[model samples]
Target: MLLHLPEGGRVVHEEHAPITLPKGWFRVIRQREYVPGSVRIVAD
Candidate 1:
């Protein structure tokens, strides 16, 4: 996964993965992360 922090907001890129869901059977994959609030923003 690739993450980009632009001047306005944040961007994220993720690769597909396999996952199981309740009630039904399915597969899915995703990438994600959390950014700290201490980071400075250009607008806010």
Candidate 2:
């Protein structure tokens, strides 16, 4: 997904600490895992 932070912001996840970001465009990528037949986002 594409994210745009005009005035900057913070990202928080349950398994990770809050990440501070500068004002800019960013790409959000999910962690992927490979299964027997396909690849998918890693589950926590």
The positional error of residue 25 in candidate 1, measured at the CA in angstroms, is 9.1
lDDT of 2 by residue, 1-44 (tens): 99999999998999899999999999988999999999999977
Best by TM-score: 2
Work out the TM-score per prediction.
Answer: 0.19, 0.71
Best by lDDT: 2
Worst 10 contiguous positions by lDDT, candidate 2: 35-44
Q: Which stretches of candidate 1 lie over 4 Å from their true place?
A: 1-26, 37-44
What stretches of model 2 exceed 4 Å from their correct place?
A: none
Question: Candidate 1's residue-wise lDDT over 1-44, tens digit each?
Answer: 34333333422435545433334323333644456855443431
